[model samples]
Target: DEPGLRVKLAEGPQKFYIGVDPTGPSLHIGHLVPIYASAHLQKAGHQPIILMGGGTARIGDPSGKTELRQMISYAQIDKNIASQKPQISKLIDFDNTNALLANNADWLAPLNYIDFLRDIGRHFSVNRMLTFEAYKQRLEKGLSFIEFNYQLLQSYDFLELYRREGCILQIGGDDQWGNIVAGMELIRRVESAETYGLTFPLVTRSDGKKMGKTEKGALFLDSSLTSVYDFYQYWRNVPDADVERFFLTFTFLSVEECRALGAAEGSDINKSKERLAYEVTALLHGEKEAVKAREGAKAAFSGGGDKSGIPSEKIGKAELEAGINILDLFSRTSLCSSKSEARRLVLQGGARVNDVKIEDAEALIGMADAVDGELMLKAGKKRFFRIELTD
Candidate 1:
């Protein structure tokens, strides 16, 4: 029922090529959907060609964006690609002979503009290309010529890979349906070969917002960017209405098992959530980190157990000695968005230190407040941060 299915290629053994445009320094949780889909292909004995859009990233893919993306230098693009390689390898088996890791820059960088426009460009019809949703959405807002060429380059990636490795299938999020089909058509026209484009549904919550976003920002795969605890908790806190669908989309659980768990009613849904949280966290951050995060989550919500697993902030010797203002502390440590927000929470009794409600917005904590060299900070019901002082 999801949109964007042009031609369903017959299933069996096939070479699949999936590309990720590294628009940012790190990938968010949304990128996982396609990566998981690629993993599913790898598991089914199909070959996976993981293409990093190093070349296309320079111009940017205009699909599913309201505003134009700022162009990044080649240096930055390489850096982002280097960082993402490991995060992706964690999900897909890159070491196998059936898999390949490629960057489009290898073929796309040295491409002569005029020759490209003459050959590949000649095959594409501008009139028909504009009809695709990707170009249509940006046309009203005035799409750039460079962005307009993005589909051509992406399509060329498929054609190039098809020649080099005989890769015929391309997969990505449904928003990329237009570019994908363009690639398929390119292969058929130029190489006289049949190719396929499969797009998975875009991830969106029942609330009508994209998933993997929070007050903190995007849920990143890298633990340094988004901690394991925060990542685990994001999945743990999914709405009751969405739990059933997410189980199928994110987890590798069998259909019948997911159906049975998702169908559970009322309080029993919490158990389903815990499983979802644990399973997703394990996949992203290994089972050991997931176990620790689970324990920390249990302690945060249940009011007992070791709180070391909870997100902790370390204060300097001078900081602990001088005693920091609670508002400033929360704001600086990213517990609260701003000092004013921290003030509001404190005044409303939503801010607490070591299980004690903060009485004043201007309250400051001195050394005496450091219980056993660590202080537990609670922002409202579910958020917990442990402030530890280095003596």
Candidate 2:
């Protein structure tokens, strides 16, 4: 059962609030749990407020950490906030009658230190605070005063939202339950308001590893950081054990529908994963982009056919005329890890140029290989690139 939070959510003109710290410039798969839940609440006819933790981000939350995160400069924080707006806008309709976007710095930046300590800080207890999981863990690892005060500032943000926006519910991941409960308690003590806190399960891979990360680094929502084709493939290649959960946690598909997809696992799991990838990619990057990304993946993984789906990169005519080695080209485009790896791939019959296998490691590719002025290169079973020769 999803608990009665959704039921209770239906009983009144209630406003729901969820906070996301601008610790990074983009949201990843890790953020989808809360974002999808908030979007669900909105679809169910409740108001949803997304609080951008511009102020608290400066202080840095120490939850699930042994050391304080490096403080981001004010300029950097501002830039991050600006970058996140478009990505968030794609998920929920902010123009809807019941949605809001707020920045905590609006209030936190102007507060008097004495007043904050005398009023807001009065409701918090050191004895109770130290018992929190985040604080207790940090204490063992040497917690700082600035990190210690994080919960207080976060709790104050909740209370302020309740007062100003009439918000009554706060949503976050399970790791944030301690901080969330503190916020609910603060609202009860200071404003005498009955606010609710709901924590969703954190998403993890079947291998018990966290999602949204690869050997390279975090999978950013920004296309510049991760190409749409790569993003689609990330979801498509999800372990069968984790695919259904990804659909449920990341998509608007109902539980019953998700279950139906899960039940077909052994025989048709690939289809389900494809649907998951397409739907999720469409939500983030739009249907057209998702379609193109899917096509690009097929072309890259399916071997040389029509070169239309290959991702293109521009090169100089002089370079092509001079005849570039296939191994060097693969390495330069990041299609493979190193020149040695590229040569190894060619030697193993895993490398191809313009749909033809390259057996010679030192074979120089020239303009003759360029069809319609572009040369398509294939590395192994899942990588494709197009080089455009330009004068």
Candidate 3:
């Protein structure tokens, strides 16, 4: 926070906002920090405005992008907004009168181009705009005129929200700092009002990999996009060095508890990781799903506890009786996306069926491989899949 923000916050309950563009249909784990921050603030008696960038999403945010973002249809953007609300609502209470869900399209879609240029466009200086890190980086890769205008539109969002909703602060990732400051400047210039901006650090693991990123892709909040079990496992497998920071950043646990849990050593750290996974998963999915996922992980890893949580696919009993190649069987489940990938996994000694390492890609899997009408397939040490035999 800027120096004045502390004093401003002390002044009484002030409304703060965070803007999200519906660029994708699902909210990834990357989106959770600010949402959790908003929830924390709202719990402390401040109002929260969750601005849905329906209009600006059309232009797309150029910040943190190396190339022009692919444009999606307005229908898709709207669908994305709808998809995101429930995920956000898991933390932010939409039922509260003080919480607002705003769409920038409501005002921006009806604007007259010339009028906007005369009113809002005249305030931004191109030379200064280019100096912002977002544009400076984009300039090397060719910044589009549409992308260049994003900061201005985003600034207008702050100004408009201030006028209508009395919102005075913006929160987002540190990558959004330039835009957030631009909005603060715009609010100061246009309304002669002092507004604030706060940004959360870009979270990463101790190994320097991005937080919530998996070999599969981003850890999406939508179970269909990233399965609930996989989501649980991602946190469950977080590097020991990351446990404390992630607990403080991602969960509502107290500082002392997070520190103590993060300090766990050797085998004890695994329990801390499991608790972290359960807490985070419960926050996103329901507690029931988190328990199931935990049990599924335990079952898959140790062969004890509920096996129902493991990801499974059904195949005919006749198919297994007829026999399928090891590579082909792996390709059939989420364990592998294609036969070529399965071949690579098998050749690398990462493939297993019924707890036995599969050394040959061409090895045939028959009904003999089934244990209790199911085949437990393992990829590497962590990935597991259950293939169920059906009549």
TM-score for each model: 0.92, 0.86, 0.97
lDDT of 3: 0.91
Question: Residue 28 deviation, candidate 2, in Å?
Answer: 1.0
- The list of candidate 2 runs beyond 4 A from truth reads 1-7, 265-267, 303-310, 323-384
Worst 10 residues of 1 by lDDT: 1-10
Over 4 Å off in model 3, which ranges? none
Local accuracy of candidate 2 as per-residue lDDT tens digits, 29-59:
7876888888887887888898999999999
The candidate with the higher lDDT, 1 or 3, is 3
Write down the worst ten-residue block by lDDT for model 3. Answer: 1-10
Better of 2 and 3 by lDDT: 3
What tens-digit string does per-residue lDDT give for candidate 1 at 1-391? 1122222223466788889877777788888888988888788778899999999998999998866899999999999999888888878997845788899999999999999999999999999899988889898898999898899999999999999998877889999999988888888898887777778887889887679997778889887778788888888888888888888888889989888888988889999999999998888779988898999998888866567778888887677678788898777665687999899888888988888889687788878777878788888877778887886
